[model samples]
Target: MVLVDAAFIIELLLKYSFPVLRDENDRIFNKPLMLQDVWSHLQLLENQLSFFILEDLFVPEKIPVSSYGEDAEKLSIISLSLELFTSLMHIEGIEENLKTITSTFC
Candidate 1:
């Protein structure tokens, strides 16, 4: 969860500097938009995260890594992300949030 939050913060930095990609008349292009508009979208994301996550609980337990050939850091990240996703699914009102997300995004 901490890593996810850090990545989001990093993405917001490019929200102003990066060009917005658009699809129009079956053609796609990058266009610059107002910084205020980008700020509002980023603010909305912050609000949604707060609304969805009711509690933040962290249990720090070390995972043992094999001494042989596998990559330790990559395996650790994948394991952590899966654990976080499973817990997030059980949060209150998560069903409604998932429904809203499917309609809004997909």
Candidate 2:
């Protein structure tokens, strides 16, 4: 269950980072509200997979840096997680708050 959860989150992030990778038939991205629903579910504390598990499973070193272009820093699980979560927020300085939360955990 843990691995499945982690994989799902990681896959969603990848699809988000590179829209070219998103399948035309994928219901998650195709349905107007599905992606938002998924994001909301991710906000639930009990639904989270530990960052360590995600990082370890992500294998960042194996992925080519060139694929991320100049913003290679965004390739990390932390950045991807932030990009996803921050999209749901309308608050000012939410990125800073999210960074603080992540730093506390790391």
Candidate 3:
């Protein structure tokens, strides 16, 4: 159920982020647009990371946090997710993505 919720959230947001591209002839196109180079890869990774954070955040309350020494698996996973999020947020473009995400949610 948790996994389903996470997947749903990620997919929904991805649908909302329809990227468009323009050609030298001033023609605009979507999805089928060709993307290459390190910069493009970085942008793609940043978006994916942002989406992962968004997915996890949508149901933070669903992550069970048990007492000390009493079934901590879920809690640990949640912590790890947040840790990764914070670490990735330090990346250049990711901050913008996070800010956009935060603004949208709040």
Candidate 4:
């Protein structure tokens, strides 16, 4: 169940970045507030997954290369996450913030 939950969150992050990859019928994407709602639920401490588990699931090798010879793998999971949440959270200095945040976890 933990793996499934983690996969769901990873899928949310991926689809958040690439809207084209999202299922048109997905209820979460169909309702704007629903995504935020889910995000809120995920923020609860008990609902959280370990960062290592998320990283293992979203490893670079698991991502497929795109036509431009680039993949979402180029960005760390932290960056991909910030790409979605930073806007919702109204964060500033994303690049610098990412660096500082990533360093702490390292």
TM-score of each: 0.21, 0.76, 0.22, 0.80
CA-lDDT, candidates in order: 0.36, 0.78, 0.39, 0.77
lDDT of 1 by residue, 1-106 (tens): 7557544533333221222312342111233344344345545644445422222322212323322244332223223433334443344545456557546754
**Could you tell me the TM-score of candidate 1?**
0.21
TM-score of candidate 4 to 2 decimals: 0.80
Ranking by TM-score: 4, 2, 3, 1
lDDT of each residue in 1-106, candidate 2, tens digit only: 9999998888898788767767789879899999889978988999977778998899766655536667566777887877766676643566777678778987
Model 1 misplaced stretches (Cα beyond 4 Å):
20-106
lDDT at 63 for candidate 1? 22
Worst 10 residues of 4 by lDDT: 65-74
Extract clashing residue pairs from model 2: none
Best by TM-score: 4
Better of 3 and 4 by TM-score: 4
lDDT of 4 at 49: 94
* lDDT for residue 16 in candidate 2, whole number 0-100: 80
| Candidates ranked, most accurate by lDDT first | 2, 4, 3, 1
Q: Over the stretch 1-106, how does candidate 3's per-residue lDDT look in tens digits?
A: 5465446433332222212213344221233432222224434643344445554455524432333244333232333333334543553445466557556765
Q: What lDDT is reached at residue 17 by model 3?
A: 28
What candidate 4 gets wrong by more than 4 Å, as runs, is 65-74, 99-106
